[model samples]
Target: MAVNAHAASARTATARQPRLRIMVLGLRGVIDVQGGIETHARRLYPLLARLGCDVEIVQRSAYYPRERRRRGWRRITLTYLWSPRTRIAETAVHTLLGVLYAAVKRPDVLHLHAIGPALLAPLARLFGLRVVVTHHCADYEREKWGPLAKAVLRAGERLGIAFAHWPIVVSPVLKETVETRYGIDATLIPNGAPMATPRRTRHTLRRFDLQPWRYVLCVARLVPEKRQHDLIAAFQAARPPGWKLVFVGEIEQGDGYCQELIAQAARDATIVLAGYQSGVALHELYTHAGLFVLPSAVEGHPIALLEAAVYEVPLLASAIPANLALPLPRNRYFPVGDAKALARQLEVMTQGTAATTAERRALHAAIRANYSWRKAAELTSSVYRNVARGGWQHG
Candidate 1:
């Protein structure tokens, strides 16, 4: 659809629709939170607000800024509820409290993100609150979780699929998995990345002591599932001359994986751990990097990869299903977590063209055409209307 058509459609639907009072669960907070789901929320809620939805996102008190926690964001209300930020209990405890608050002051629909928060779908249903679940990813597959936590996450996905008034999946792969396992169709809504601002300055490069087009960049949380070690090993083996390896992301307190990365960077001068960056700094990194790499073993829909594409950076990712969901030339993918294959691929890519002007224009145009936060928000508003009106007879 063209831009005009989307706007016209939005105007038409929102004109007659009753303003939806929505309560959200799942996530630390939207403001500068570093996770994929947080990114999803930050992009989505503002658009929903524009669509005339009364949005109130419940936040964990431990992570969100105290002063602005209740001050709200962009017409959306944010209620900061108490939560013990312990590793294991954080999501469950925060979500339990969120659901209780929802029950007391019932919203039109209680929206849940990810399977962890979706675990309480049945309890929310018992209170007669309409629930909608967005299955962002299968958290069970993340490398950080133990066996018990994995099992719990799986169960949470199951319960959410079976109980929510509407279950939304972020990728086509996830939609298919749930349909086969639970015998229900979920609404498919992929993730989106913002369009890149023109990079006319090298301020970030100077700040990070980086040279433009001389760094291999990977922006993701320093989690084991992200497979940064594999990328480090590949960078070390390939040793692309004059190219430094940079990881731009954050990790939790005392993260052993980050500790390992710090030690590795200490030994190798070329390896730079540039910690979390947002706004213009992140844009600078994405736009100026020599190449972008995502060596993750799993992903629902990688916003980082989308950002790289939006910036027209050369892309190389693991041949995982989620990463492969985006169209790319076959040469861009390596076997998942295989350092040797990545090293060989890096040799082929770094030695040649990153992207032509025509190719970059084509990709930037394609990304803008295909993945859109506006489209996602419009569809979400429709789902809210239906679920609030009890339109879909979901199991």
Candidate 2:
């Protein structure tokens, strides 16, 4: 049988009996948080709301702040809950609070993103709320986690799949893992990418001291697993003359990883670290890039890569399973962590001859055909609809 990796097309005309209510947990905040899960929620919940599902995403107050709390974006309601800003306690505290809030409000379904927060799936179920968990990635595989944290993450995955009324996996690779290991089949609803408008002006380019179509761009948080250090090494080895390398991600905070990366970028005149940009600034960067690269050692259906593909930028990534899932030429990929191979590809790709108009159209068509917000939301709402029908229940 084919893998359950398909999403429903956004059939806007579908009819429904009294609307379904969904409470979301397990995210920092959808308002420009650094992780891919944030991006997923930012794109998803509004569409869910539009699809006749009553959607409310519970966010950590630390990230949303007092003034921004309880604000609604598009059609979706943003509900803020308290949590410590510390990495370890944040998800646990916020989600525990979110579950209590859900118990009080009593939504029909609770949607949790990522395994960390999904650790509370059993608790959510015990509280008499139908639970749906989206496994964004295998958090245990990340390099930053210590043994205890990794063990906790493994337990999170187990509890999330075992207790959820419906388990959703972001990619087929993850779907297979859940089935092989836990003997549970997951609904595979892939991550969605937005249709972005290209910034027509050169203001952002000039601000970053970058020339149009003369830079290689990589957008990811400066984490070890993301491997921005490896990208920097590869770019230096390539030294694609006249063409600068630009990094677009969070940078102001001085964690050990961020400090090392900031100092490294400072050494190279051609390397630019454009810190924490969104909106038009990010759109413009996508529009004018000569090439886009994602050399991360870890990923789960990257939205950034899809954003680049939407703009028809020449794509290159590490030969990881997630990156390989994208439809790019095989030659576009270098071996994972292989700076020498990446450099060789970079040296040859410096010209950045963009695809023709026909190619650009085809890329947009492919995005519509494959990854779409409307479709993913429709698929997610179907889970809510099923929960309303009172068939699947897990203890």
Candidate 3:
């Protein structure tokens, strides 16, 4: 839909039928990968489009292929902007460029995802764009960032909370943190998880020499805070017969932690490093896995764990505040970074006394009902409408 047409229609509509032109920033491009924020964008914008909104996503040029650049996906326009590839420079530079673009395009709302890109929220607002920031996580707490980077991220959070027309947080813990720290009443819009159909193909399993219901799976970035090392140690200690342990995500560039994981996995033939996977391959792994584990030391409502729940896979996770917030049984949790405790839990799960089939089905239904992309889209669209009407106020 044309920008002018959308704006004109929105102006003519009644209060209840307001259409919005939205521009989203802060993702590393979408339509072909599996990062938490990126996956959220890929699933959300399309649903927003169905709700009578004109949504356009701004992507980093470096992440998109030459052919895929300048194309639209699912009625959402793709606007590519260039940025430096370095971690410190990537989000700031890309968001600056995207803000300038939004300034020219003059969208009804500029929705920024993640606190890193939200550093530019004030700048976007200065250009007369209504800004809505989604606080995906408190990035400064992540182990990867140094003192200087952490300071910058904290500053970003403060600026985003103070300047944006509305702020949304994915988890209740984060919502309370922001409320207490910044004294801002932000909207609580958690991430959604869609139930996936099991893939018919066994190519992903055959490639790794894995068998149906004979392997444990974890799909997360190989970072220190994710604590893949602890999971590896627990799996090694459990030593479940005939079961493989699979790790399915790429390591950060220039990070030596993945190399450590690779060396550790090499000590056992039963362990497989499948690297990054999505779509069918990822679905297959989630579908037939004997168990799913999320050993993260930190998370902002983990999409991987929610996906595992959608597939009805038995779950084992750390007892972090974020993980504990999920609708899971007490027995499914182990002490954070406790390999021995995790091993004991794993042994019990592998012994076939985990959740029964009826319980699994009920859990699956609850998960699907709780996290709905359509509901997220509707709530987000309401935010846009409120911002457009100048009726939104922070408490």
Candidate 4:
């Protein structure tokens, strides 16, 4: 008999509707305040809940006593210890705790996020748990891991891909990488942004005391791989008189990338570093900005870029194919790592062309019409059901 993972099991008549009891694993707890994986899970869970799944979002910290949650700095320290390399020991200490909590809560499927939780897959299988892994980052051989850590993580990724019942990926570049490197078949499900409604009332824009000026907005972690330094150089070279350059998002650990960027901006009145903004402030910034730019050389799929697109803010980004793959038609692209080329693109946007307005509208409509969280949630829910039913097939 043949099986289909895409469809729910018809054999069990008692199964009125597949109760997707999903145990979500990955970057849980405090790390979420900074990373995309955390944000994705937080955004996704409530949508999944509404979709009729019995969902339990598990973080390693859940195993901690209530008293531990109150100690902020100590909690952050413990989280780093819970990183993937240590997850074998970490999971041993906490997976049972995670599972016991799930059992009491009674979940039906297991959906794990991030490469970090892949270390626990072998154990998840031992319990007859169905597994689905969302391959979020590119995790290119060059980027993550030092000499020894790279080799270990590369091997771990291979094992994670092999063991997963089904793998869900965020971009074509990632799906292609997994297929070519690990022979893992993955579903290409792009990331979605919240539908943007610009909050650009006179009061809102005036509250920030900004004049009608064209500015470029760049939102990404201030990390080395993000190539933000290149962006600063490009903005300086472009030298648009009234045009300001603003970068949103926080800096990563040990990297003085943000400080370097600030130093570069010191002489330039046009370049400003607005440290992390969320809620209404973030939305207003995106809405009011003339363009959104991201120069990241490494990405699974950036949520910030997606948010920029949904807002119909004209995008000026690096030429990385994955960044381009997100249905952005009005975008202006520059060669990766080339500050000069990026500067040229910025000049064109600032100069203003007849095509800009039309292109922006078309791109905005395309994103809103196609990329939606509801659709992503529904498709992802199907993957969970497929794995849980033991019907997953390898490509």
Q: Top model by TM-score, which number?
A: 1
Tens digits of lDDT, candidate 4, 1-395: 12233323332321466556676766555333555786677566666665656655555554444566433331122222232324235544454455444445445666667665565656666666677778888553434246765555565576567777887888888889888987667887677778787785545346544544377888776777788888888888988767788877764435566678777778776677777667777788888888788998877878888888877787877778777777665347778899998888888777865136788788778877766776677667767666666667462
Best-performing candidate as measured by lDDT: 1
Task: Give the per-residue lDDT digits (tens) of candidate 3, residues 212-300.
Answer: 88899999988888899898899999998889999998755666898888888778898899998988999999988989999998888
Q: lDDT at 90 for candidate 4? A: 57
Consecutive 10-residue window with the lowest summed lDDT within model 4: 74-83
* Alpha-carbon local distance difference test for all models: 0.88, 0.83, 0.85, 0.67
Clashing pairs in 1: none
> What does candidate 2's lDDT look like per residue over 1-395, in tens digits?
12223224334334535777888899888887777998899888888887778888888888765765667888788888889988678888888999889989989888988999999999988888888899998888898899998999999999999999888898888988999999887888898778878888878899989998899999988788988888888899988878889998887475888899878877888889898888888999999999898998888888888898888888888988888887776788888899888888888888555456676567667776898887788888777777666745344
Clashing pairs in 3: none
Q: How close to the true structure is residue 205 of candidate 4, measured as C-alpha lDDT?
A: 46
Sorting all predicted structures by TM-score, with the top scorer first, yields 1, 2, 3, 4
Looking at candidate 3, the ten consecutive residues that score lowest on lDDT are 1-10
Q: What is the C-alpha RMSD of each candidate to the true structure, in Å?
A: 2.4, 2.4, 4.3, 5.6
1 versus 2: better TM-score goes to = 1
Model 2 residue pairs with clashes: none
TM-score of each: 0.96, 0.94, 0.93, 0.81
- Model 1, poorest ten-residue lDDT window? 1-10
**Residue 319 of model 1: what lDDT?**
97
